[model samples]
Target: MIKALAAKAHTYVVLADGSVPNPTRNAPGALTGKVNTVLGILAWAGTAAGVAGVLITGAMMAISMRRGEGSEHMGRLGMVLGGCVLVATAGPVVTFVFG
Candidate 1:
């Protein structure tokens, strides 16, 4: 049974031209501009949000520091900075990998 199954699989795997098929890479049409515009808007919004997060976290940290609780907000600040890094790198990373 194993031998028969292997033979069947071999037959199916052998293509008529012995070449692998490749998909056509075509540019996105019609809605491409609209899609790009939306992506740009989202990117801008994300950057703005990151800036806001950092500013808010900084204010909180400052306030907490006055109360001698500064260390507690360090984690929140780190997270906000990390998010900013991610938002900044996401587009370039995606383009580098895909293109």
Candidate 2:
């Protein structure tokens, strides 16, 4: 019984010390954590700004229509400009996620 108990304890000790190996740690040096944090924040910011641009464009169009005195052409132009910004922001987010 004592020998069995000792064997079990030894097994437990070995298993307890085993660690999960991180493959990233085995690779060549990569960018530091700070870079990742900054990139992540920038990605989130881009998405937020894109959504905000869309909202602003829509609001401008709505308000202008209600006023009934401004150029519809300018309102359309605002929408186009917002769409362009949204696309520009999307590119950064995609790269951040998959690259």
Candidate 3:
């Protein structure tokens, strides 16, 4: 079975014109501007949400501390910070992988 499948597989190195075929990478032609605008808006929203998360978490932590409670809010703060890190790195990681 493996041998038969291997024999059926085809690999093209050159085209009929004796030229090497190269894959092209590009964004969509017509909606490129709109797509970029949407992406920018989403990025901005993610950043704003992250900021709000941190601020809220900080406030909760401060209130908890004032009550002489345990450091339970630390976990929430850590989660907020982790989310901020993810938001910060998402665009760069996607660009590195696909660009």
Candidate 4:
């Protein structure tokens, strides 16, 4: 049964027309300027948010250190640094994951 199913899967064409599958019939076309503008705005907003988060985290880390918190300060510093790394590599990470 497993072999028969595997054979069928290997031989199947999901679209009866045997043409390239286009799953985005209703999707926004890539040629539209509005899509690009919206995407750019969103990207900039995300970057700004990440910068704000880093600033806030740094302030918290400073306060923690001023209070003589060794471990907690280190943890906060690590978190802010990790966030920076993630934001910096998000595009590549997404591409790698999707591709």
> What's the lDDT for residue 88 in model 4?
67
- Pull out the clashing pairs in model 3: none
**Candidate 2 overall lDDT versus native:** 0.70
Q: Write down the worst ten-residue block by lDDT for model 1.
A: 14-23
- Clashing residue pairs, backbone N/CA/C < 3 A, model 2: none
The candidate 4 region of ten consecutive residues with least summed lDDT is 19-28
Q: Which is the winner by lDDT between candidate 2 and candidate 3?
A: 3
Top-scoring candidate (TM-score):
3
Query: What is the clash tally of candidate 2?
Result: 0
Residue range 1-99, candidate 1, lDDT tens digits: 999999988867865548665657677786877877998999999999999999998898888888886376778888999999999999999889765
* Residue-level lDDT for 89 in candidate 1: 96
Among all windows of 10 consecutive residues in model 3, the one with the lowest summed lDDT is: 8-17
TM-score of 3: 0.73
Best by lDDT: 1
The reply for model 2, stretches above 4 Å from the true place, is 1-31, 72-99
* Candidates' RMSD to native: 5.6, 10.8, 6.0, 6.9
lDDT of 1 at 50: 98
Every candidate's lDDT:
0.85, 0.70, 0.82, 0.70
Cα-based TM-score, every candidate:
0.69, 0.45, 0.73, 0.48
Model 3 stretches astray by more than 4 angstroms: 1-22
